[model samples]
Target: MTLLAPGSAQVVAGNRRVGMMALRIAGAVVLLVAVAALVGLLWRPFAFWAAFNPTLLGVLRWTLIGLAVGWAFLFMDAWRLGQPLSLQQNQRLAVVGINGVLCLSVAGALIFGAHVVGVQRDFTIAMSSDGAASAAEDGRYNVLLVGGDAGKGRWGLRTDSMTVASIDEETGRTVLISLPRNMTNFPFAEGSVMDKAWPQGYNCGYPDCELNSVNTWVGENRELFKGVEDPGMNATISAVEGITGLKINYWAMVNLEGFKGLVDAVGGVRLNVRQPIPVGLPNEKTFHYIDPGTRTLNGHDTLWFARAREGSDDYSRMARQKCVMNAMLHQVSPKTMLTNFTEIASASSDMVSTNVPSSEFGRFIDLALKARGQKVSTVSLVPPAVDTSDPDIDKIQEMIQKGIDQAEGTAKAAPKKKKPAGQSGMTGGSLGSLSEGYVANQADDLGAAC
Candidate 1:
């Protein structure tokens, strides 16, 4: 009776008040869990908050432990109330065994739950950002994503890939704005430290002032960004904001080399192989290739698929990187995340350095979930349409605005940029060559492009 209803034995033995109180607690727990589950499904942001909030998780952990201990005590009290000494030897032994089994099973389940919650708490703490949260700019969150080298230096040093995920705050509709690292003669955000240095734009007689060199420039000219902890990242943000005409809400820098570990943690990501993608560096002797097919690729091959520039231009590599991003969004499931969260979190911590505060996790998580079902849009400032050596900032900003408006259904897409003559062949494991501009670069529907 105690095992079945938690306090029915006490009720039967005339400890009615105590029994009622115990039953109420048990009922409250069940009710709370059920209500939480329902609310979580209806409103995902609540679920995110519950899962990511360290203080709440800590409270939940202690609550589970308390429930386990309290329930065990009630079971023991019920066992005592049974007056086993007056019963048959076999009956006494059976009663004692049942109570022991019930206590262990119930307590064990709660303890396990507590452990899972603790693991999640630790993960949030590990990834916690020191950055202050910012309000969405013009009803959207424009996040700068930088892919750089994995080394001992600053996070923004040598940003090989720079993409901005401008997300709608309400719909989670996204427009990926990619900037070529080699872009030159671009302006910095007005009134920014970099802007003060070169009021006209980031143009020097020498080549050290390219888009990717912002980090190095900041390091050399520390006097410009006084009191800033991550001057390079701030300067980089300024550059992106200036180029895209989108105010950056936050920035995250990921080490390109550490991407392999993140991929492996999710078991692997599925991607349709368009062509034979190279798997090793150009100088590698035992060169291998990821055979063509729709396949699930492990960490190493996937990394190379996105990174390889062998027989491919940087533009093609950028297209493939967007494909990798799309694949990860669709393939990595919520169930897979729950099961392998620790490994995934560890890998992410190693690679990604983000200024997204822990408090905003719920909002971002909800948006990501919403985005999974929507068509992602892309706007790569790449060839044919853009001349990276000296990009047209005014035209690029117009392109960006059109992309955002198209994604939100407020405007029609501009006519596709005409490809150059004889640019029909597929290169860089994507749908089109650099001259033609890969479909993934400027697509209304990213899935078809990939």
Candidate 2:
């Protein structure tokens, strides 16, 4: 009877009303849950609604907790109703042990799931509490991604990798504008504080005026930017705005060392190595090489892969960094995120510092989801396209505008002329041409180019 109907034994033992009530309630709950699961599977909006709604998340967290506690109680009550005292010793022990194990397993899984949800909630709170900046007048969000290196003996933090991710407000289409650290003679936005300081341009009275050096310069001359909270960052923003001809919305700085922790948290990232990359500094007498091939790299090795310059130049490193960024964006699946939720949240909070407020997280998250289905375009202001030693601001601005137009589908890209049969499409070098591995100075389809 117990096997045929969970509460039937109790019914036969004279608890007829209670057994009937339990059976009805359990059947109704099972039916409701199955229907809901079916609906969630058939209706995509149902899942998205929960993801975008904070209140829904809260309700889910509590619901899981309640269900776990209530289900455990039901299992305990079932064990008691089994009347172990009246049964033989061996049968009684088996029934009690089975009920206890089932109770613990179900309750434990639900409780663990609830804990994970709580951790995600805390992460959301930390990310969203701050207010987001208003969109630019052009209706785009121009976010500066700065890769800060704070290695020992380095004077202050140096922003070696800089890129402006300009996102469309409605469609979420994006254009990545990469700037060479060695770019010189770039102008700041007109009439801005930085422009006032270097009215002519960000040109030190010397032959070498590196763009990356601007961070160190601003750090040394903080008094010049008296009211600025982060002089170096502000100065860099000014330069980037001037170079890209895009208004800045917000900035996010990632500590390169802390970046390793994030990769590790997500079980590392995979990449296809085109060549053998050396790690460690030759000057320090430390040499380690990452053999070429497709494989998953741990935190330490991934960091070096993104920042290595031993057998490669800065341009090659920049291209590699973009590849890593792409891999992280596309490869980190939802299941991986859920499984490593706590570790990822902890690592992300520690590694990243951004001016983007918490209020904008949901909106951005939605946008990111939208972007996942679209192609990502890139334009780098590097050699052959523009002289890094003395960049032409007008040409750079034109290139940026053109890339934006191309990405938005408002303007068709110029057709690429066919290369000679015997020659490589990209420029001939160790890393090949900028467009060889989709490492283009400007490309409509980054993936195709690679």
Candidate 3:
């Protein structure tokens, strides 16, 4: 046998080594994807138990389940890559496989965290803070859930859906009020384009602003609501306080993207449709017409439900919106969560932004636990209470007085049996009485700051 030259042998060996390294790197990538997927699926289970009592065992169990699902998908991908196809085709197949695992893991994790954070933050604020607890004690806690819709070239944020949620701690009841974006209100904030609402010229020293003007002014000054005027958060919060006749202790503003991510994170929520919604929105937007059934929805479908403005206008959309929320809640409960952790977690990364800190998570959990066996109710601030045609100024004042009376009344009432121990420190002094709820009488027509 002829012996090869030393130089040639070395060059061949080097080529072999390079090929081996490339193969090893590719294998590692696939392995990592599988591991990540497994971790994702088990996130919910891990988080739920973690809330009860976070332990090494819980994490390990969740990780193991995620890995099992991930490995199955990995093998499936590898097989697809091995099929007879062009180099690009094989590459695409591997990517799809990797993405599948990645998405699954992210979904599971996000669902876990959303509930973990949402419940924890909301409840803790309601329980520990005297301000928040008082609102609940007073038979109402108005939660302004604002949805932002910012279009190109627009100077302000458009209110998509303004929902005020009231929780009555005494009865463990919940009432939701939806405000129309176009509803007119007085200029609560001073120096606004509309000034009739503040005829007193901000003399009350309410930050030198009137209630109606507050939203726009705050939007102009606060970096948060960059381009919007009236119905700005401050304005909205104030308006809500005016209408409900109760003090608002907390606010959660969610934008379109965050809403979509939240819906998609938990595999897909199932919603019931009573009527056929028309497809094809204006500007070439393709919308979904949800059929009456137990229909499952991903992010896109959930958005369609939220954005549906045809057929029944706002009322129909409101019904659909509630359905979507209910569906999402059902999908994200503890047991289902354990399996979808990764997807849920990843989706949440895009959906929610709030001021509630992570440290207060445990308190939120306590509230959730307390609310579990309780009843929830819904209320809408539509038609009779206030109308779209009413002048912005007069309507806003009515809302404010309503909030004050409600706040004061709840503060003065004798502590009920259901009042949580040591949870009674809302505002200082007597909150006053709701002797008259929503007084449209001539005497109280003038809106005043609390």
Candidate 4:
């Protein structure tokens, strides 16, 4: 009887209706699970439905919770129907223990799944952006990566590092375009509010107007961008779009100070250090330096490694920041992510604010997985190529287009030339003695260049 029906013992004991109802419920659940599995096998539809619909996700979470409770109750009832009281003590104990273990295992997994769903729900709610999802334009999705800092006593926020990562829609090949923070006399996009406000460019008459200063300026005069969700961000985007000659799809701002916590959460990032880097201001009584070599850096040290300016200029710092970004892209593995998922999520929610909507996470995740296997190229609008102080906008756009073409395989990259030893290959300008192997502004392969 027990072999034919799960609740047959109860039926044999004359609770016929109850036993039949339990069996029906169990059969229905198994059928439902099988159907769900089949649906999951056709993953595209499932992924689209799951990724875009918050209500469906919530319903699924509750369904799992309900199934877990119902299954536990059914298992316990089946055990009760077995008539353990009439069995020998050892046999009864064995049956009871087996049922208990099975119940606990299934319930534990379901509860953990429910917890993960709750975490994802909270994350989506907290981080969902105002921007709408859109397709890649002209075979690329150009995203602005802004490194913002709102340090102690600093008014508002300053975006000191700005890079545009243009990713190929099909191949996942990426080219990072790094703009100098101090670049001046750059145009904002025509018809943009920023352009209307300062038709002559982001020039403030004197030499104080710079690319980085645009954020602060926008913040001071927010009324100029009456309907903008983020005035500073919009202004910066206009400047970047004008400079790069690429349509800006979305932007993500990372708080540099909060970045420390994220690095720690990922355990740490491994970097191949070419030279010793100062960690703090030279004027301070005591300062520490990160010894040169291949080493993993903690959050605090990594921040300094990326932003230290005591013995380095902003250009050198930019080069280091690129190295750091490259290392993070390459070294942090899926296993590391799963191991520290909660910490990483918590830290990221605090660290990053982006206009890339939550619904698009799946798409980006797929792109990131694709990117892992591809070589990343870089082009910077610094020195030799374009003057940071007074840039030639047309020439700058041409350089950027050249890089894009090279990445797309429409044009081959120029051959590398060897530089004489003991001489700085590129002009470091006021920034003295860049780190060894620091290839400024241009590289076919960023990892190898650093």
Against the true structure, whose lDDT is highest?
1
Q: Tens digits of per-residue lDDT for model 4 on 67-164? A: 67866766687787777899999999999898898888877788888877766666666777756897897989999999988565342357779999
Ranking by lDDT: 1, 4, 2, 3
TM-score of 1: 0.90
Which digits, one per residue and each the tens of the lDDT, describe model 2 over residues 249-342? 8888888888998899999998877777777766666677788788799888888888887656777777777777767876777788778888
Best by TM-score: 1
Global lDDT of each candidate: 0.88, 0.74, 0.46, 0.78
Relative to the unseen true structure, what is the C-alpha lDDT of residue 16 in candidate 3, on a scale of 0 to 100?
47
For candidate 4, list the clashing residue pairs, or say none: none
The candidate 3 region of ten consecutive residues with least summed lDDT is 441-450
Query: Tens digits of per-residue lDDT for model 3 on 180-271?
Result: 55554333334332233444332344333433334555555566444543235545665555545456666666666556766666667766
- Which parts of model 3 are misplaced by more than 4 Å? 1-141, 150-156, 169-172, 186-217, 220-232, 279-288, 369-375, 391-450
TM-scores, all models, native as reference: 0.90, 0.80, 0.50, 0.87
Question: Which runs in model 4 stand beyond 4 Å of their true positions?
Answer: 1-52, 87-96, 150-156, 205-207, 280-287, 424-440
Give the local distance difference test score of model 4: 0.78
Q: What's the distance in Å from true for residue 59, model 4?
A: 1.8
